[model samples]
Target: MVHHTMATSTTRASKASSKINPMNLRLLRFLSTALIVGTLVACSTTPLPPASPPPASSTPPAVGAVPGDTAPLPPPLAQAKSRWVPVRWAELPGFSTDALHEAWNAWVKGCERPAPAFAPLCGEVRRLSIASPEEQRAWMVSRMQPYRIESLDGNAEGLLTGYYEPLMDAARVPGNGFNVPLYRTPAGLGERKPWYTRQQIDTLPEAQAALQGRAIAWLRDPVDALVLHIQGSGRLRVTEPDGSQRLVRVAFAGTNDHPYQSVGRWLLDQGLVRDATWPGIKAWIAANPQRVNELLWSNPRYVFFREEPLDGLDAAFGPRGAQGVALTPGRSIAVDRQSIPYGTPVWLASAGPTAQLGRLVMAQDTGSAIVGAVRADYFTGWGPEAGDVAGRLKQGLRLWALWPRQP
Candidate 1:
């Protein structure tokens, strides 16, 4: 079987020994907002451009048939990379260069990768001297649309973003799915918001009626709680009141009723909020409805839901007793609980904008797809940004486990 490799071009302001893989935190925020707000249609999701006037069915010179003598097949994505790419909003194509430097720079901007090579963009800029604003604008327009075409009508944004998760994994039990819920205009302005709970919805009477028997359900509030999935039987290593460490096997996935506005300080790396420190940020999000989406979308991590300790909350959201603080979390990942051993130290290589925030950070939690495989989803912290960023990314990876080296 033949394999294909893509050559990317990128410029380097600072050279580093290791490459970084991060996703766009801002985009993820929009994605989270997308669910609660509305489906955002980019050209990638736009209806296929009107088909090119049917090409004369013809044969190529290489084939036995003479040119213009046979049938014509649709060109490959690379061949037609420009035409099919969306030009709406942020999804535009970028300029191309035959020169190696420009080619190199483009690769860097496209994905999160370790760095050791010279700046591709520097070379492109210097060599072709095509770094002019006009050239740059044309180049950016060429960035392949991120995802398949989506609806842009505000009403459609929520619908499309809403379906991203269910489309990928059905067993995806919901928990205010987006870490930060969308706080849009008072209800009835647009589509109803989606919601979820920590435990199975079947347990709650309201959930049953809300779901109406669907494996999954949407929330009207958007800012519902999220329940992390627990797996396997590893004991949490926590020290007890007696000053001794204890082992408490944990659920691969756990449940919680945390809110999007609740975990700010920590998610954004700000300090704790003491007292009824004003509904400050959350209130602002609620009141600003006109373009709340744009404002929130600017900062990706702004929409993350936070775990305890950092946010002054507890394991469950308040003071979690000795269990929460001393929680010697069975080394595991949040996404795939059972698959990735709780205590194993794994290296995560993400391919998005978020990874740029925390480069090569440790992976303490576990998720389903996060098992032994070469894949990872950074806890994008928690909340809407976390949810949005987490859902949008899918990339190939390299994994390493921290263990005693073979003698």
Candidate 2:
């Protein structure tokens, strides 16, 4: 669970220009003469009669105009959520040393549903998948412009937190030690704006009845189940009724719509714990087992999940992020969409007790807690090591957006 809320090179145009035929050259010369005559005549104040439209060409330009005649489109205006100040490549920390090749996989994944502004560059990005770090670096420097990301007030500093997919054992049917239920979206879930609070789902018969027969899997520990809920996704090793086993993923489907109240903050406010990390919480739970229900009920928000098979290449990546692509571990990050558009390539720099990172990442997801112009939630992948990193990483951060340069 998150502690705090928080490409390409080209010369395609030049290559196409070099292939112009003699016939096209003569047509261009004639058009240039016509343009000169029209410009001279336009000096008169009198309005000229509209001329008959010229015959349309059989082969239209790939771009909206005659390819060579069109000027490059300027970069988009600053996003409302953040102010982007143009900066030189030299200003980016670790620009000369970051392994650009390490980030290419995520770039390819992003091309599946790229933003309109980024759609044109996807081909070059895919071609560079096997490119050496130096070549990729050079391509980026030539093709993209870096901009220092800041808040509307020009605050360049922000907070960074971490999140990871949880992994745990589960049972197809409730029995033995696996009793805590992880459910699919309950019937009538959409009938009410806020379906049911966590406490209500636990104690109210009507709420419980609504969720009857919806459990997808039963986990051994309630805390482990809660971790899945908080993380919004997880992988489960399931023991079937027939004594067979399979690994499956449970992805976020919907929420109860209640506001999320941080359980850690609740403990802090009650003077019950000084450390609110997952380990600390588990330690506290070990000492005060009877109060587990009280601790969980502190937050009314509840999350439901959908089961997906873990197979083939899908097993190699995390769940689909908000950008609708499988997340690349250590390469995907959740950001405020208002601050940075989805599928944008970003330069991330952070140094803290838990980690010191300077690399490239993609903006592919978002979260309720991840709000702010410069704030981000790093996706640490799955399993125990990832959880350890996600549980403790909350530190200072800086970001730069790497966008395509003008044609």
- Model 1, which residues run further than 4 Å from truth? 1-340, 352-359, 369-372
Give the whole-model CA lDDT for all candidates, comma-separated: 0.24, 0.73
lDDT (Cα, tens digit) per residue for candidate 2, span 245-322? 777989999898888777777777888888777777789899999999898888888889999997544555678889
lDDT minimum window of 10 residues, candidate 2: 6-15
Q: What does candidate 1 score on TM?
A: 0.25
RMSD to truth, every model: 21.8, 19.8
Q: Which runs in model 2 stand beyond 4 Å of their true positions?
A: 1-77
Alpha-carbon shift of residue 282 in model 2 (angstroms): 1.4
User: What are the per-residue Cα lDDT tens digits for candidate 1 across 1-407?
Assistant: 00000001100001111222111232344456655854321111101112222222211011122222122222221111111111232211111211222222222221122122222333343332234333433432232121111122211011100001101111122343322221111223123323333232324676445434332212222222111211111112333335453222222122122232222333233322232111333454466556344333222211111111221111211111111111111111232223233333332222222221111122333322233223333322222332343333333333332221111
The best candidate by lDDT is: 2
